[model samples]
Target: MSSKGSHSGWTRRRLLGRSVLAGAAVAAPSIVKGAQPTFAQTLSISALGKAKIDWQQFKGEDITVAVIPAGYFNNLIDVAGAFEDLSGVKVRFEKIPPGQIRQKILLDLSSKTGTYATHAADPMYYPLYVTNKWVEPLDAYLNDPKISDPGWFDYDDILEGWRSACSIEGKPYGIPFDGEATVQVYRKDVYEKAGIKPAQTLEQFVANAAKVHDPANRLWGAALRGFRGAGQNMYIYPSIFRAFGGEWFDPNKKLVVTTEPAVKALEWYVNLLRNYAPPGVENWNWPDIADAFGQGTVAVYIDAHSSAGVINDPQKSKVIGKIGYARWPRGPAGKRVTSIWNWSFPVNAALSERKKKATWLFIQWA
Candidate 1:
């Protein structure tokens, strides 16, 4: 089946052609159908241009990268093998659990430790990295004609409101990778039964959720992360704060999580748990949520797009062909907020310039 959305023009073959061609003209197909490009494959011509790296020059070095477990980019052995085949450098990859990634990074960098030379991280750690000076700055690498593409990695694709999130003061600290945002997922069949369209407001969202929740049929109204640890607390509870016009920190940048809005957001999340979610949901992480949605147990999901590929995987999802997605609901603020990151390969400052260059080359291939 075509992954092409209604609005996109290019398809898988055309996207591949564009990637290979990079710039030269192509003869348009007469009856192109059912093959629009995947979002990841649709790189702007400028991005393809900027991704060029001279792998032949970086021949005799071993490059290692530290990545989070289940990290999609890191797990691409085909890309790594391609890089190794093109360049003689052997790739040493390591996956650290999310709970221990920070400490391990700190130990490696602070001690100028062995073999651990590069990092791939979510930008949420940017604040900590800057305060600790954990990773090297990429300004030199980005400015070097061999590496950075200013136009392709422009502020527009990064989104304006999120610019400050990844930047420290004014310097770009980290590149964004994947992010979690709650897109609306509802049972279109159930909505049709109840005579309601997809919702736009908080009240509407709640009402729709309640309507579709049929316990006799073992269907749940919603599925969300509420594991009570950093992952759940950070992703699921924070949106409620925004819904109530609350900010995590004050204008002066002090932690003010105790405010009324913050409390209300927590309350809303707790209520979601009590009312809409399936039993035993508070213990779920990413897998459980994906499974719940795939099994037809969930009527709604307010979670990350990181699981987009999994939801559509035919082997695992019962609702693979049935799901419909929309943006998160609006609140009084009239603006939407979602998390984003630049999960890029970051070289260590302490490494020699040659090694750093090789690291960037591997990153380009990655």
Candidate 2:
């Protein structure tokens, strides 16, 4: 999408052009300075719904982007044209299904198929990416002096947990974008009507869920994701496990799937699903979660904060202004555990020197 008058709020320019690989930047001298871009010069980017992707100059060449359809990012139609305008490289973005995106990329990279020059995958996969050596290191680009707006990334604003996940052995593996943390989303009106404050601990959360749950009146206490797949296994399970004093791996990084915490967390989660959730929650994903919260069928939604935008949007939500946000409830461990969802862009390691240069340039400008 076209962005006018520069990005406001937080601008990151220092990270530009620091560690850029010489060959990657130097190989695309032609695309870099050869032809003047003939794309539309002016596009309205100030208004939320007014932005358009500039497709004039990007009629040819090969480029691809991977994206998931959720959060405010469902507006993927706006990114390509702008990239095409800035670089003559043709843009070919591949949007993947939310549940399948991570596994798809992992499989692609592990097999060395290298279909995309650049792809946007979640930061949660950083551990897998690093382990498999499927992603190219971004330090060169980050350290390059010619790149612009390195600080635009706002590394500090990212949650520390996510930061730790993206980094391995003190080296960063991905450029982070978008943040979704599990927070307590409740019905302010209902809470007031019941004269109950928002819940802040596992004990309090369960009690609150029971209080708000009135299934006979068609209102459930909570909306939980219990679908048995990556969504359930990864997204929904982590928080419960953590709250039950479970860590995915032992101190030595070995899997601890059969630990006491694991059993307790799963038991608690299953109980919530069996008692407090609405019908057919076993099939829910992002949309189902958003719909439940929006339709006011669930009084407390302990899901990602990304749904906040959708629930708060007037055009899409039926209970727009009534939903309120709060810190996640405390667990037995005396800590708040929130699941992390992140999307990030990565470059393919196997591209030709010429293509690599073009890809690096495109990523810098993007």
Candidate 3:
């Protein structure tokens, strides 16, 4: 609990900043050897034992990690047995749907139930956690020699934007486990067939989508999230908001959504979806968009770069080699802004000391 950091890496200025990984397909460390994700990429059971820390220090402890049943977290579940074998700690990862998990985690945190020792928390909630001191400042565990090896952990390998989002006032409340940035996804075959080039600006984007908007053939030009959840519509909106040079607040931190750029961006988005995208595009999320693209219905769309992973899976994708990616298009402001997203694990403050340490160990390892 005495954890604090004077290092500039942990600063309040970066709380919840969006980040895009530089040139890496995936942010998490992995050495995969096959098409499907497996434990082969995660840390080897013996490699973890060679670390200086005593992996078995908290043997016989039990900790539960609350997580969504997403690909990133499911990948962790596949390899969790390695940690359990090395440390003798029983880890129960409770996978819940996103909507229900939020309610569960909020209830657990607000009530101080300690039911979940850790969770893949929403970054936006870090400020509230820091304000209420509801989560452990992770600098203690990161710097503690007996518990972690900073060099081996390679915290620096993580993008600064992701690191910043998990920290408030230089105190890290969470450890980033997965991250992605918004990018333009399109079908190479569609573009080649239509002779449409990738859009460089917002106007060009619409034009390009229009050229490929073939409703008669059952192919739509583009898609964007219209669902109302925070991770749904709100998630995709920020990129367009930033691209139009619309900041969330002014100098006095006053909310400013009525500005010219903001309105223009909103109108542009509505028109794009209303005119060119497939039916019920208004209710789509990232998954729906990805699924549509993989099924060869959507000619182009903009979303998290990670969608490539799903669309490239030959097992389920119909456009494996036909898909393409590019940086998000610029808006009237001449700025290209990509939405940064991540999920991180934070230790619950309500847990007992032993359980907290056990949770930290799990965070470090898996």
Candidate 4:
């Protein structure tokens, strides 16, 4: 299908295209109808630019990167060999568990050991990293003509929200590799049977969940992350809090999580899980919730957009064509708020200039 037609309408291709790794499962057609470019036809222009990137610019440079075992790691592994061959840059990946990768990177940065030239970063920690001068500012390399292919790199193609998310104090410290936002994905067939549309408001969301819930048949109304920790709670609760106009801290940085809006949002979040989620949901994290959704046991699932890619994959999901995606529901305060989750690549501030430039080239390739 033509790129214009593929994106202008809500075809399965378009739906999956929004997915993080959807390209791996779906085969691209060799030819496209009409006067439009096929995937291969567009590659010459889209891959980099008319002016190809000089991959060998930093040949024979070796750099280490620290990454969590997540989607980005899988993507990197898929093309790391090619990058090494073309650029003569020996890439070393230090795989760390998701929960510990942040701390590990921070320690490496603070110690100034330069153990890792570049590390995967979560935008949530941008403030902390910027405050400590742990990450290198990427503007110089990004704009340098000798180092980067501005036309091919197509920095503007990145979504503005993602760009802003990786920036601190108007300076970009990281390059967003993958981005996700909280969204509602539901069983469209179930909603159709119930004669209901996707929820637009928080109250309607709960009502829809209750209406479609069928425990006798092993189906639950919703699946969500409830594991207690910064990892789980921090990911799921902020949307509820923001929707209800709850702020975490005052202008002076005084704690405000105990305020009325905050308490109400928390109460609502707890009640939904307690009443509508599957049993043992209190221990569920992103993986558990995703598994439940993929198994066709949940009517509604709210989490990162990346999970939708998995749940929509025919090989991994029971509800491959039965899903519908929507933005997070609005709250009583007439606000719909969602949190952005991104994994970015940032150079270590401690790396030597040559290493930094080489790392930047790899980042661009990635």
* Top lDDT model: 3
Count of steric clashes across candidates, in order: 10, 24, 2, 1
Worst 10 residues of 2 by lDDT: 13-22
Candidate 1, 77-194: lDDT as tens digits: 3134445555666777666655566577767777776466677665667667677776666666667766544433332344544555667777765544433456777666667777
RMSD of each: 8.7, 9.1, 7.4, 7.0
What shift in Å separates residue 365 of candidate 1 from its native position after superposition?
3.5
Q: Rate the local accuracy (lDDT) of all candidates.
A: 0.61, 0.63, 0.77, 0.75
lDDT of 2 by residue, 72-170 (tens): 333322343444555567655565667777777777788877777766666667777777777777777566544433343334454676656567776
- Lowest-lDDT window of 10 residues in candidate 4? 28-37
Model 1 ranges with Cα > 4 A deviation: 1-53, 68-71, 96-107, 146-164, 177-181, 229-231, 332-334
Q: Order the candidates by TM-score, highest first — what do you get?
A: 3, 4, 2, 1
Error of 4 at 319 (Å): 1.7
Q: Over 4 Å off in model 3, which ranges?
A: 1-43
- Candidate number with the higher TM-score (2 or 3): 3
Prediction 4 TM-score vs. true: 0.82
- Tell me the lDDT of model 4 at 37: 28
Error of 2 at 38 (Å): 15
lDDT of 4 by residue, 1-366 (tens): 112312311232233233325445442222111123234323322333222467677787889877765554554543455456556778877777666777887788889999988877878888888899888888887788878765556565667898888899788988887778889989999999999999999889999999999999999998788887655767888888888889989999998898888989998899999999999999888877877888989999778887765686677789888889998999878998988878888888898888888898878766
- Most accurate candidate by TM-score: 3
TM-scores of all models? 0.76, 0.77, 0.86, 0.82
Evaluation by lDDT, superior candidate among 3 and 4? 3
